[model samples]
Structures are given as structure tokens and as C-alpha cells.
Target chain A: MTVAIIHTGCANIFSVETALDRLGVPHILAEQPAEASGADRLILPGVGAARPAMEKLQSAGWDAALVAETRPLLGICLGMQLLFETSEEGGVECLGLLPGHVMAMAAFDGGRLPHMGWNRLHFEIADDPMLAGIDEGDHVYFVHGYAVPVTNHTVASSAHDMRFSAMVRRGSVMGCQFHPERSGKTGARILNNFLEFGA
Target chain B: MLAKRIIPCLDVRDGRVVKGVRFRNHEDVGDIVALAARYAGEGADELVFYDISASPDSRTVEPEWVKRVARAIDIPFCVAGGIRSTDDARTRLFAGADKISVNSPALADPDLINRLADEFGRQCIVVGIDSREIGGEWRVHSNTGDPGKTRTETRATLEWIEEAIERGAGEIVLNCMDQDGVREGYDIKQLTAARAVCRVPLIASGGAGAMAHFEEVFRQADVDGALAASVFHKQVIGIGELKAWLAQQSIEVRP
Candidate 1:
């Protein structure tokens, strides 16, 4: 299957490409609207503020292109936040793929902001296909300040300052607030699950 | 809940991992790729690779070595030292570094932190502050241990940390010169002072000798992570066993 990782000028593209390469998954990074349209599956990888990232994507027409793509798609980190309706980060509107708003994590008991580091995944659906082979309480790497609330669209949740969506899915489109590309063996397994996922 | 991190810091020079006492008397450990893979397998939460040669020689980061390690280990790892510009950070990130740390260069140009945070995201920038107590004031020192180079300005340490955060530093690596490699324990005074003003994740580095030292720092300071070198390198403490001990002690760590 042809895979295209949509590059919106955010970092972590090479990390994702490297992860896919190590998993022996052939993939190409597509930055242009024309280039992004040729893949069978797509991934929106991100690592920056919502305002600037949205500005660049909207300017290049990727925001509309991505929403229009009916193929299986995955978003990571800021890319995941961009799938929501709006974000308190930079007070920006997002792609509206999912039905929630991304807001700042409420004051943590004593934890740090950005909620950075490894945390266990609490699955809403224990047998989620995207999390196949990923055991309960398995640790995944996370790094972000804004997060969507746990709603029906959330397939998994993780608690840092408060309970937030760790993984969300609606039909064929899914997103992970954690970086599966950088989460080691469990990360590689999750990527494989996404690769093998039949939409 | 976010688990407390156990980071193994690898000081690399000429592609080999080295351990230094007080930033001097360096001794080679092993291949960085091999050690990084071992640490990841042993349940190390993250890895910090400092290019010791970068600042001294005034050269850029070694992307080839970074790519080698990135390919070998799947866990998140950060590359630090001698990064001065957004292009420098971009080179490392494109080469697969999860985060890029800036030390002396940031001291020279504080705006680089904002530029890096804007381009690569705040999560990708770590401001490393090597500090020590002088004249009863916690002063921010450079990573270099030269006494003449140390700055004891009244508000230098806390001010730099606050400015870094405002300018967009996602994390802080508070390495205390007075306690580094001494094995007495972490610099609680320094850590607590920095933690008081630090809004981002604070990583306590240096002076880790045994399991209890780790416990002391985690318990005493509200740090998000603890970084060590000699203890892990000399087999004084294994990552797996130490993590187990931390868990047993009620300190949360990834298994």
C-alpha cells in the first residue's frame, strides 16, 4: 500500500519516516497538495503551535485536502490537536474532524505542564484495532500542553493534569496525542496496527 | 499519570560514550548506539546525548552518529550542545533527534530559544543550566566547569530560567556544579529554587550515587526527571533494578 505522511512544515516528519523505515514500511513524505493526493493512506504528523501550523496548512490548502481525503489517516501530537474543532493554544480553529475543543490542561496536582514524558494508556475500548497487541497500562511517550476532553470519539485516555484523550477515532480517521514514532517497541507496534488497519 | 523519568546521560566525543568527573578526566565507556539500545531495553525513560566536542571545537552536531543511534533505538532521545541556530536545531531534528538542547549558545543569544520553540515547538527545546552556589546565591553557570567563566550575578539563575520559559523553553536541565559527580545527592537547594519559578518540566542532573540518592532528589525536589551517568555506566546501578527500587519506594517510573 502506498503511504503518504502529509508534511505541514512541522517537525517529527523525519522521526515518523525513520520509524516507518525501521518497521520496513515503505512511505513517502508529501508536502504539496498534488503530492499528498496520491497515497492510499495518510498521516498528519505535527510538533508546533496550532496557529502557525494552521496558517501554513490553510495557505497551502492542506487543511481542506486532509479533511477531503477519505483514506485511513492518523495524526500525531499537535497534528492530533489540529483535528479538533478549536484549540485554546493560540486560540485557533482547527480542521473540525473530531467533535471537541482542545484546551489547556487544568492545574496538575504537582506534575509539570506540557505533560511531557511516558504515561500508561487507558483504553475506552479494550480491543481497539489501533491498539492491538498494546497491553493495558502500557507506557507511551506524550508531549503537549493542550488536549481534547474524553468524549465518545476518544478511544483511549491518559491522565496527567486531568483525564484527556490519548487516542481518538471516528470512522476511518484516528489520531494519537502521543508520539508512537518515538515510543519504542510499543510505538512500532502501534504504527504497525495503523498500517494494517482496514478502513 | 505521567511517570517520573529515569534518563541516562551519555557524554559523547568522537562517536564514543564517555563519563567525566566534574566535567573533566573523561573516560570512554562504550559505543553510544549500543549503550542507548541497552538503556532503552532496560526501561530507561529517555536518553540525553551531549556532544562534548561541539562547543570546544566550535563545530555543529554530528548528524551521522545521531542517525545511527536514532535507527538503533526506538525510544525518545535528545541531542544537546553547540546548537546555536534554528538551522542547527533543524539539522538534528531532521536527523531524528526528539529534542535539541542549547546551553552556552543560549546564554549568548536568549532569543534562539524563542526561534527554536517557534520552528520546532517548545517541546523540542531544553534549556540546560549548570549552576552552583556562590556567595550564598544560586548562580547559573555554564556547562564548562572553569571557575573564571562562572557568573554569580544576583538574579542570573532564576532570571535565565524565567526568561527561557517565557521565550518558550519546554524543559529545564538543572545541573549543579557543586554536587555533580560528587555522589552526595542532587542539589536540593538549587533544584527547589529553580522548581519554584519553573513552569515547565524540570530535570535534576548530577550527584546520583545510589538508589537512595535518586529517592532523595525525587522526594525532596518537585522534578519531573532525574539524569545520571557514572552510576549507570559503572554498573553501580542498573536501570531496571533502580526503576524497580523507585517503584517500591512509591516513586512512579515506567516498567
Candidate 2:
């Protein structure tokens, strides 16, 4: 099966491509919506802020195409934040595929900003296909200053200054605030699971 | 809870990983890609590669090794040592590096940090400071701590750290030259002092002799991460063993 990785022109997508290569999964860098729509699965890999990323996707016609996509699609980091209704970062409206708003993480005493490093995932939906082989309290890498609050769509939750959605799912649309491509073996398993969708 | 990170630093010269005592007397370790993959298998949280010979002439790391390491290992790695501009940072990042660390260049031009943060988000810009205690005060050193040529800057360690953060450095790697490669322990006194002023994630480098050193830094200093070179390169300490010991000490670490 072919997997299409949408190029959002945000940050490096080479790591994600290399992860797919290691998994022996055939993938393509889909700069256009048609290439993405024609693939069996889609991955929206991004980094940087929300507004410019959204503008790139919108200009590339991915916003409308992704909104209408029925196939399994996953968003990573800023890509995940863009799947929501809006973001506190850049104060930009997003794809609205999921029903929530991304807000800046609250600052508490002694808590560092950006919430960088590895954190445990506390699963809310243990049996979801995306988390099939994953266990509770599995550690994943995260680097961000803003995150979405825990909502009904949250499949797993983690905390820095406050608890936030670590992984979210709504039908075929899924998002991971952490970079699975950079999270080591556990992350590799998650990507492999994404490749398994609709197989 | 965010687990404290354990990072293995690889100092590369002529494309071979090397380790030295106090940033001198360099010795070859192994090939870069093999060691990287081995460390990832051993459960290292992340890796940092510093091209020791890339400065003064070559202003950027070779993209070939960065690409090979990215293709070999699945974990996140940071590339440091000779990144001078946004184009250089972009080259490393596009070649698959998760982060770019600036040292001497950032000290020379603090605005380089601001520019890198502006181009690629701050989260990917790391400021690596080589510090040494001179006249009872910690001072920043330039040129990778080469005693013959390394110049001690007038910028105090704490002041530079605060300035770097204000300039949008997402992380700070405090490499204490006095304690580096000595293997006694991490410079807890300096680390604790830096942690107080550092709002960003602080990584302690230079003096990691045993697993307890890692514990001591995480517990007493409360730093976000601890980095070492010789211990892991010489196999004096195993990553799995160190992590298991840290987890038992009630310090959160990736298992």
C-alpha cells in the first residue's frame, strides 16, 4: 500500500520519510492534494507555527481536500494542532476536522516552556487500533509550547504544566502531538500501525 | 510527567567519533552511524554530534554523515559545532537533524541565535556553552576548549545563558570545561546556579563519572538532561544499566 506524506513546507519531513523507509513501507512526498488523495493512507508531517502552515496547506489546496478525505490520515506535532478548529499560536483558524481549540500551555512555578523531552502517555482508549501494541505509560518525545486540552477526542493524555491531549482520534482523522518519527521504537510501532490502517 | 533525558554526546573529527579528556587528547571511538544505531538500541533518549574540526575554515558539518545517521537511527539527534547561519542550520535540518546547536558562532554573534530561532522555531535551536571557572567565577570559553587557542570570553556563564534564552534559545547545554572528561561528577554547583536562572530546559555536561552522577544532576540540580561522552564510548557505563538504576532511585527516565 502507498502512503502519501503531505508537504506543509513547515519543517523537515525527511525524518518521517526515513522512518517509513526503515519500516519498508512505500511512501511518496505528496506536494499536491491529488497525490495525497490517491494514496491509501496520508500523513501530515509539520513543524513550526500554525498560521503559516495553514496558509501553505490552504494555498496548496490541502485544506479542502483533507476536510473531505475519508481515508486514514495522521497529523504530527504542528500538523496535529492544525487539525483542530483554531490555535492560540498565530491565532489562526485550522482545518476544523476535530472539534477543539489549541491553546498555549499554562506556566506553573518551576515548569519549563516548550515542554521539551520524553513524557509518558496515559491511555484513555487502550484498544484503539492506532495504539494496538502500545502500552500505558509509554514514553514519547515532545517539543512544543502550546497544546490542545483533554477532550472527548483524546485517546491519550500527557501533562507538562497542565494535562493535554497527547493523542487524539476522530473517525479516520488522527493526530499525535509528539513526533513518532523521532520517538524511537515505540514511535516506530505507532507509525507501523498507521501504515496498517485499511490494510 | 516528562522524563529526564539521558544524552550521549559524540565528538567527531575526520568523520570518526572520538572522546577526549577535558576536550583534549582525542581518541577514536568508532564509526558515527554504527555508534548512533547502537546507542539508540541501548535506549539513549537522544544523541548530540559535534564536529570538532569543522570550525575556523569549514563553517558547516558535512551533510552526508548527518543523512547517514538520520537513516540509521530512529531517535532524535542534534547536530552542533560550526553552524554559522540560517542556511547552515537549514542544511542540517533538511538533511534530517532534529536540532541544530550553535556554540562559538552564537557567542561571536548573539543575533545568530535570534535569526535561527526566527527561521526554524526556537525549539530546534540549542545554545551549547563551554564554561570554565576562572578566578572563582564561571566564564564562557570559545573554540571548543582548545587550550592553546581557546579564548575565555568576558561574558559570564549565567549572563550569557539568560541572554541566549531572551534571544530565543529553546535549550542550553552547559558544558563545564573544568569538569569535562574528568569523570569525577557533573559540576553540580554551576549546574544548580544555571538552573536557577535558566527558564529553558538545561542540560548538564562535562563531569559524568558514574550512574550516580546522572542521578545527582537530575535530583540535586534538577536539570532537564545530562550529557556524557567517554563513559558511554568506552563502555564504562551501559545506558540500560544507568537508566534502570535511575528509575530505581525514583528519578523518572525512559524505560
Candidate 3:
């Protein structure tokens, strides 16, 4: 199967590219929207503030392409936040593929910001194809200052100072707040599931 | 709950893994890629590679090794040393490094931290402080504590930690020069003081001799992670065995 990774130019995509390579999956870095349109799967990976990221997507024509995309698409880290309606990081409007607002993580009671480390994932959906073979309470590496809250679209939820959506799925579009490429074995399993989503 | 991280630091000099005793008397370890893969397989939470010899005049840690390690291991890894500018950090990050750590350079130009944090986001910017206790006060040391290289800064350990966080540092890796490579245990007394002012994830480096030492640092200082080099490189403590032992001690670790 072929995978197209949308290069937003806002963050590094090397780890994600290497992850796909390890899976023995053939993928291409789609710098333009047309290249991504022809792929079997698409992935939007980013890491930075929201306003500038949206501006890059808009200028590169990915914003419109992603909005019209119907195939299985995945967003990682800041890319996941971009799938939401709005973000508090830069107070910028996003792709709005999912129904939620991205807010800064609350550091209540001296909780650390950025929530950097390995945290356990609690699955909210039963037998999700995206989470196949991954057991509940499995730890995944997370590095972010803002996250989406738990909602009906959340497939798995993890907490820092408050519960947030670790994995969100709505039809063919999905997003992960954590970097699956950097989360090790469990992360590899999740990526494999996404690659084999519809056989 | 966020599981406490167990990081295996690889001190690389001229592309070979080396461990030094108190910032002196270096001993070669092994290949960077092989060791990185081994640690990741053994369930290490993360990996750190510091190019000990990287300087502004010399080439930064080659992107070739970073790419190899990223291809070899599935876990996250950070690269340190000689990252003097955003361009240097960008090269490593684009070459597959998940994070870029800065030390001496950040001290020379404190604004470098702000620039890095602004361009690459604070999550990927880590400020490493090499500290030494002198006259009963924890002092921040520059040039990796090598007496031949440079001298210590006047800024107190806590003062630097506070400034780093204020300037947008996402994490702090406090390396206690007095305890580094000693293997007696982590410098809890110093780490505890740094932890009070550090709002970001704090990692304790230096003086990890036994498995109990890991537990002590985690429990007493409540730091987010513990980093050691020789102990794991010399096979004094296996990552798997240590994680299992930590789990048995009621400390949360990724299985």
C-alpha cells in the first residue's frame, strides 16, 4: 500500500518517514496537494504553534485538500491539534475535521506543563481498528503543551492535569496527540493498524 | 499517571561511545546505533546522545548517526552538544532527532534559548546544566566541567533553572559534576533544590551506581526521569532488570 505524508514545513517529518520505512510500507513525501490526493493513505504531521502551521497549510493548498479528503488520514502532535476547530496556543482557527477546541494543558497543583513523558492510554472505544492489538493502559510518549479534551470522537484518552483526547477518530479522519513514531512498540502496532485499516 | 522515564545517555566522542569519570579519564564504550537499539529493546523510556567533543569550530554531531539511530530504534531520542543555533538544531531534528539539547552555548548566549524555543517550539528545546557544589552551594558549571576547558558560572543552580524555564526551556537535564560517573547514587540534595524552581520536566544525571539509586532519585526528588551512561554501558545494570525492579518497588515504569 502507498502512503503519502503531507510535508507542512512546520516540523520535522524524518521520524515519521523512518517509522513508515520500518513497517516496510512504501511512502512518498507529498509536498503538493495533488501528490497526496493520489495516495491510498495520507498523514499530516506537524510540531509548532497553530497560527503559523495553518498559514503554511493554507498557502500550500493542504488546508482545502485536507478539508475535502475522504480517505483514511492521520494527524500527529500539532498536526492533530490542527484537525480541531480552534486552538488556544495562537488563538487560530484550524481544519475543523473534528468537533473540539484545543486548549492549553492545565498545570494545576504544580503539575508540569508540556506533559512530556510516557503516559498510559485508556481506550474509550471498544475494538477500534486504529487501536487493534494494543491493550489498554499501554504507555505512549507525549510531548505537547496543548491537547484536545475527551469527546465523543475520542478513541483513547490520557491524562496530565486533566483528561485529554490521546486518540480521536471520526470516520476516515483521525489524529493522535502523541507521536506514534516515537512511542516504540505499541506505537509501531498502532501505525501498522492504520496502514492496514481497510485491508 | 505518567511513568517515570529511564534514559540511557550515550556520551559520544569522535563517533565512539565513551564514559568519563567525573568529566575526566574517558573510557570507550561501543557503537552508538547498536547501543541505542539495545537500550530501546530493553525498554528504555528514551535515549540521549551527547557529542562530547562537538564545538562551534568543529562540525556538530553528524546527521548520518542521527539517521542511523532513528532507523535502528523505535523509541524517542534527543541529541546534544554543539547545537549553537537553530540551524544546527534543525539539521539534527530533520535528520530524525526528536529533541535537541543545548548546554555551554546556551550559557554563553542566553537568548539562544529564546530563539530556539521560538523557532522549534519549547517542547523540543532542552537546557542541560552541568552543576557542581562548591562552598556548600550548587553552582552551574560550563564546558562540561572539564577543568582544562573552562570555569564555572556565577549563577546559582536554582537561579539558572528559574531563568531557563522563564526563557522557555521545556526540560532540564541537571548533571551534578560531583556525583557524575561516581556511581554512588544520584545527587538528591542538589536535584531536590533544582526541582523546586523547575516547572518543566526535570531529569537527574550523574551518580547512578545501583538500581536503588534510581528509585531514590525518583521518590525523593520527584524528578521526571533519571539518566545514566556507564552503569548501563558496562552492564553493571541491565535496563530490563532495573525497570522490573522499579516496578516491583511500586514505581511506575513502561513494561
Best model per DockQ: 2
Residue A106 lDDT in model 3? 69
The best-first sequence of candidates by lDDT reads 2, 3, 1
In model 3, the Cα lDDT at residue B194 comes to 89
Per-candidate TM-scores read 0.94, 0.98, 0.98
Candidate 3 regions exceeding 4 Å error are: A107-110, B56-59
Per-residue lDDT over B1-255 for candidate 1, one digit per residue giving the tens place of the 0 to 100 score: 788899999988888999878877788999998899889899899999998777656778888988888888888999997899999998888888999999888887889999998887788899998887778777776637333344444447888899999999999998888887778889888898888999899999989998998888888887899999999989889999999999999998888
For residues A1-199, could you state the per-residue lDDT of candidate 2 as single tens digits? 8889999886669999999999998899998988765589899988887878899899999999998899999999999999999998878999999999999885333468878999999998888888989999999999988899999999999988688999999988999999999998899999888788667
TM-score of chain B of each: 0.95, 0.98, 0.97
Candidate 1 chain A lDDT trough over 10 residues, lowest sum: A105-114
Model 3 docking category: high
Cα TM-score of candidate 3: 0.98
Q: What DockQ does each prediction reach against the true complex?
A: 0.76, 0.83, 0.82
Residue pairs in collision within model 2: B185-B207
Please, what are the lDDT tens digits per residue for candidate 2 over residues B1-255? 899999999998889999888788999999999999999999999999999877644557899999999999988899998899999999899999999999999989999999999888989999999998999999998887355668889999999999999999999999999898999999999999999999899999998989999999999999999999999999999999999999999999999
Query: lDDT per residue, candidate 3, A1-199, as tens digits?
Result: 7899988885569899999999999899998898776689998999877888888889889888888988899999999999999998878999999999998886333478878999999999967899998999999999999989899999999988799999999998888999999999899998888888777
For candidate 1, what is the DockQ? 0.76
- Candidate 2: RMSD to truth: 1.2
Candidate 1, residues A1-199, lDDT tens digits: the string is 7789887787688888888888887788887878866677888888878998899889888888877878888999898899999999878999998889998874335557778999999999777898899998999999888888898988899998688899988977899999999898888898888888884
